[model samples]
Target chain A: MSDNQKKLIEMIVGMQSPEAIELTKVMLEEGADPNTILDICRKAMDSVGQKFEAGEYFVPELILAGDMLERISELVKPLLKEGGGGQKKTHGKVLIGTVAGDLHDIGKNIVTFMLDVNGFEVKDIGIDVPVATFIKEIQDFQPAVVGLSGFLTLAYDAMKETVEAIKTAGLRDNMKIMIGGGQVDQVICDYTGADGFGLNAMHAVKFCKEWFGVKE
Target chain B: MNTATQPTSNNELYAERVQRLNDAIALRQPDRVPIIMNSLFWHTRHAGLSFRDAMYDYDGLSAATRKALDELQPDAYVLPHPIMALGPTMDIMGYRQLKWPGHDGVSNDVPFQYLDKEYMKADEYADYIFDPTGFMLHKYLPRIATAFEPLAKLPNFPSLYYTRIIHSTRSFANPDLVNAFQTLQKAGEEMGRMLGKTVQFIDDMAALGYPLAESATALSPYDLFADYFRGSKGIMLDMFMRKDLLLEAMDKAAKLIPLQAIPAAKHSRSKGVFIPLHWPGDGLMSPDQFKTFYWPPLRKVVMTLIENGLTPIMFWEGGCTSRLEHIMDIPPGKCVYFFERTDIFKAKEVLGKLVCLRGNVPGTVMSAGNPDDIKAYCKKLIEVAGKGGGFIMDGGSGIPDESKDENVQAMFDATREYGGYA
Candidate 1:
């Protein structure tokens, strides 16, 4: 990596604003391919996710780092498309969203970042995503996995409904469903008929890896 | 030796009662393993009162607590607090009125107004820590007034002066601030005496345990100072820049707490002091941040309580079994952890030998379900957590006010039926 690419990686890791964008510009000027820059950003974020899992970092830090990565990805996206590197194969596709009636997004956001780093093409549908959105996204993305998050007791039902809707739509066999959040439990997961349940962010990653039959 | 025939004296009875509870804890063989529903606001509400009423009325408070105890009938009575009047008042004055989104009297929206836009900006921090009384009177009080317009018409208008003075000391000039803080400390000592006396009266009559005091784990001391004293945005900057000052402030806060807590514990005649392990869970602070920012002060507080002859009951808010091993270092049996989302089996497997374990019942089952559900759930919890003796039964978090009284009764009934010495 060139000095600018190194600096861009640091900026992204440190979640420093303007510094990240400026470093991205410098890397681009240094003849760094936009695809290469995206790769660097992804690597930097993967390290952040690892640190988070290892207990060296926290939610705010993850959020900050994820934001920086998102900004860098936005900057490099056009370039990746122009370079025809946009169609590069991802490990798998994931459709992740917090269930309805739950506005909390921090947990969902962390899972999204972790999946993103693990080479999963994560499509985060943000907070309070209705069941219909999950159905539509699964139909459109046809992602290998569907992850639902809810932090409230009320939202657990929404999670169950979402799962039932997916199954009713005959998508259960094709898609792997995972559920988590504060109000979730093994019983809830079984009742909801989700394929798996993750107790925390680290567990979510492990669940995904196992579900996809990927080592590590 | 008319021990069998004559009625037992209060002291003898109280001691025997406490001993029985401790024996259960020690032997892991509590007859109907004691389950304490450590609810903050709900206990008060269940007594047919409001937050303001519970804070001030000792008799009313004691009565409500007694009622709950009679209703639940756990093997032991763990009194987390007869009344935690301070933080809630500050929360109401600082942010919005407190609300209980769930049972367990968990107070939400502990708000703080920011003194500076950037908390870590040392240059601007002084401006952020100004006279809170005037601010509360001018800005927050009016808001409270409007919110409680009907209540405002009542006599003896409530004032936020105390909370302002308590929170505003960081902004004062050195010598004045020091002198002011000393005077405040003396005043607080006096207030502690009064609070203690009130608590002691309750203790004498009810024979209850101590009040459990916990903060959300997401709140580091720095977070508390920033969120409760400074604004969120400002505190974020403060964490990066004025890190030293933030640490110093936390140390100071930590030191001050024990002074009042000791007296309160004495007053309540409590054997245990409950401190919540909130932030070490998955989505909040990492274990690293917990070790760095949270663990030290918490250890200090826990150690102080133990040294002063009080047991430390740690309420692990979300899943904290992952970090229970780290907590084992804090002097065993001096602590009893109440878990919410943690793996109880793993906790029992790991920390069971080290400290007493309480809780793991899902609040949802108690709040929304029937007695049979509660009975079945308690039976399962007892089978797992009740194995060798250091386990107590409780709602996973707290019993919501809306929870069916019959469900609460069923929890106690199940404990009696299944949680025996055998």
Candidate 2:
């Protein structure tokens, strides 16, 4: 790897504020491709996540790192698209949101960030997202995965409703459904007829990878 | 004189044995599995006493607890009550006077009373600088005094008056807030005397569950402020627009908790505090929001409690196991996380050695299923979580008001029958 590439990786992994953005700029200035910078940053975040899973780091550190990585990614967005890489093929597209009536998005955001870092084209619908929005996003994005997040006990009903709606739309067979949150359990997922249930952010990524047969 | 197994008349023996349970918890071991009873309300109901009656009637409580020990033979006892009395802000402001339908203890609805239609529409309520006393008297007190009359009579009536007058007089002057909080600290110290007596009495009564010490409950400053102080939408908007104000409020609220918790820890048999996780659940905030707003205060609260010689036993409502690995950041062994729907096996693998793991039995199973089913579930949980010494077996969540007696009996029976270090 080039010195700038290595430095970009370190900035993303270390989650160093200002430094991450500055380093990304420096890498771009040094003739590094924006796509290469994005790839390296993604790898760095994945590395940070692995450390998090291995108990080497905690959530604050992971979030800090994720934030820094995002900062660097935002800087490179315009440059990457100019190189015909912005609309490049992704691992798979995902339509993700927290279910209706439940505004919680922490787990969903973590999952989205991880997915983005891992190369999945994610259309994040945000929290308190209506079921129709998920349907519309799926139709528009034609994503392989539709992930639902609900952090409330009451939102389980909405998740079930979303799944039923997807089935009613005759799109169930075309996409995989996954649900997660504090109130979500295997029982709820089974009852809701979701394809899988992710117990946490890391597990969600693992679930998506397996569901799509991604080689990561 | 070797009456270790024999029932003793003196309550002091019970206290001594209970102290040992605390020591064991500190070391992460007990003579047997320590069963922290599901809920104090249920315990009181099982003893055929009102929640209010149980709070003040020490001898009656002692007798009822003795019967429970004789029957259940648990490894420890977890009491139900916030160790410290109300803080000046909560007490004096009449926030403590708020009530809910089902429970006898103070409810978590104090902040909601301050929510006027105007407050919600203000768009800047988040940045609306908190004039503690002004917010209380003009906004919260009338609601408390009128809507929650029953709560006003419970205790700490003086603090409510102080809270009203101070807030009404000055927008943010809280000179007495610290002193009011100190009063709770004083009360906690006095509680140690009662706790010592209760422990001795219970230890002498039977060879039951270990008598463990724990706070009544704990709350993250984020939850305390957002759910109780600023309401959800207001807090969220504030985070975006008035980040500085929100941080200041959080910092002020955070400062009070540790100071109050220290005395409570001193009185606790286990030197532990049970911080109940309320928000950051499925419907409350997104995982990103949790990382931004919830985790910081939670981390701060957990760190503060740990730093102050108190262990935080977090009772996480909803399924928090998804984020369990992240929670492992707080100093290990300084906290024991109790969960509602978290993956028990995963928790064991991830946080087992680092912090004590309590709970996993489905509350529904205990409430609706038969004894055999309860036994089967408990046996499985024990098989998975009981392999290590740091695990405390409990229902997946708390035992709700509707839990069946036979099912509860089966849970205890299964533990006694199948749970041992053989």
- Per-residue accuracy of model 2 over A1-216 as CA lDDT, tens digit each: 987778767766665556777877877787778878777876788788787666565444555666676677678877865446533536888889988756566578778877776777888898867789888887888888899997644466678899999999888996888888755556567767898887667777787788778895
Q: Write the per-residue lDDT of candidate 2 for residues B1-422, one digit (tens) a residue.
A: 11235445335445655543453344365444546565544555578865445554566566666665566655555654332112322332334333321223432211011221222223333332454434444454444433232221223323457567555544223444444345545555656656665667635544343455465456787777666665554455455445666676676666667777778667644567878777655334455667767778778878877787887888877766557656777665667778777777888888777777788778645554579988998888777776646667777765543457788777888876776554
For candidate 1, the iRMS in Å is: 6.0
Cα TM-score per model: 0.64, 0.53
Task: Output per-candidate TM-scores for chain A, rounded to 2 decimals.
Answer: 0.84, 0.87
Candidate 1 lDDT score relative to the true structure:
0.63
> Which is the leading candidate under DockQ?
1
lDDT of 1 by residue, A63-99 (tens): 6676667777777777665446433535788899988
TM-score of candidate 1 versus the correct structure, residues matched by position: 0.64
**Candidate 2 positional error at A146, Å:** 1.3
Provide the fnat value for model 2, as a fraction from 0 to 1: 0.04
Q: Which ranges in model 2 have alpha carbons more than 4 Å from their true place?
A: A14-18, A27-36, A39-62, A77-87, A130-133, A136-140, A152-158, A182-185, A200-202, B1-258, B264-272, B275-358, B362-373, B380-393, B397-422
